[model samples]
Target: MDMTTQHITLGAINMEAENPVELAAFWGTVTSAVPSVGGGTVYLPPAGPGGFAMFFRPMAGPRLERQAAHLDLTVPWGSRQAEVDRLLSLGATYKWDVLDEVPHVQWTTLADPEGNLFCVAEHPPAS
Candidate 1:
């Protein structure tokens, strides 16, 4: 395999929602990513360079089970709680909080309006 001859980049993270426009709006507000709509789908451009965009499409039927993957958003040290609060105000519901003393990390799990899970985390500064 010639690894150097082939280039691969993450294009987007796609998900299904009952209302794609509303779901995209929630994520767009949370990540500050502007959205573009077309072809029955809503796309949010990456928040910054090298970041992958997010795409939301209409669901054909009710989701029967929890999603196997979720997004974990990192915030500056000591800001996880505030970010979680802000997300809640923007229509996210609290799931739980994980505070690990072994590594001294904190993160709060949350679900979007449509029940998609995600997290906000704060990590210790590099020593």
Candidate 2:
């Protein structure tokens, strides 16, 4: 096999939710993705280029523990607070905020209705 011929790209991130449809609705609103159902799963296609789709599956039982990973959403500098507030209005619970002096970074943690954690951060745009 030619090394250059091999390419791997992320297609989607799968999550288990007590109610897949509801969870998909929350995510769909957040990411501006349209949700569809097929094969007993709720699927949210990527909203734009370089974005990965999301698949929400029905959970067999209540969440047993903290999720192993979470997502970090970036916003243009000075917009983090407004975005966080918007998410709160959308049913996301505020967790906490973190500010790093050395790197001058700031982020706020929040949980979706199902308690899946994610973050919103403000950072300088690419030069």
89 Cα displacement, candidate 1 (Å): 0.7
In candidate 1 the C-alpha lDDT for residue 81 amounts to: 89
Residue 105 Cα positional deviation in candidate 2, in Å, after optimal superposition: 2.7
lDDT of 2: 0.89
lDDT of 2 by residue, 1-127 (tens): 6667767888998999988999999999999999998877999999999777999998877787857899988888989999999999999999999877435568999999999999998876556
Candidate 2 lands at a TM-score of 0.87
Write one digit per residue (lDDT tens) for candidate 1, span 1-127: 6657767788999999899999999999998899899988999999898666899999988896868899988889988888998999999999999897458678899999999999898989989
Give RMSD to native, each candidate: 1.8, 2.1
Clashing pairs in 2: none
Angstrom error at residue 61, model 2: 4.1
Clashing pairs in 1: none
Query: Which ranges of candidate 1 are over 4 A from the true structure?
Result: 5-8, 101-104
Question: How far out, in Å, is residue 118 in model 2?
Answer: 0.5
lDDT score, candidate 1: 0.90
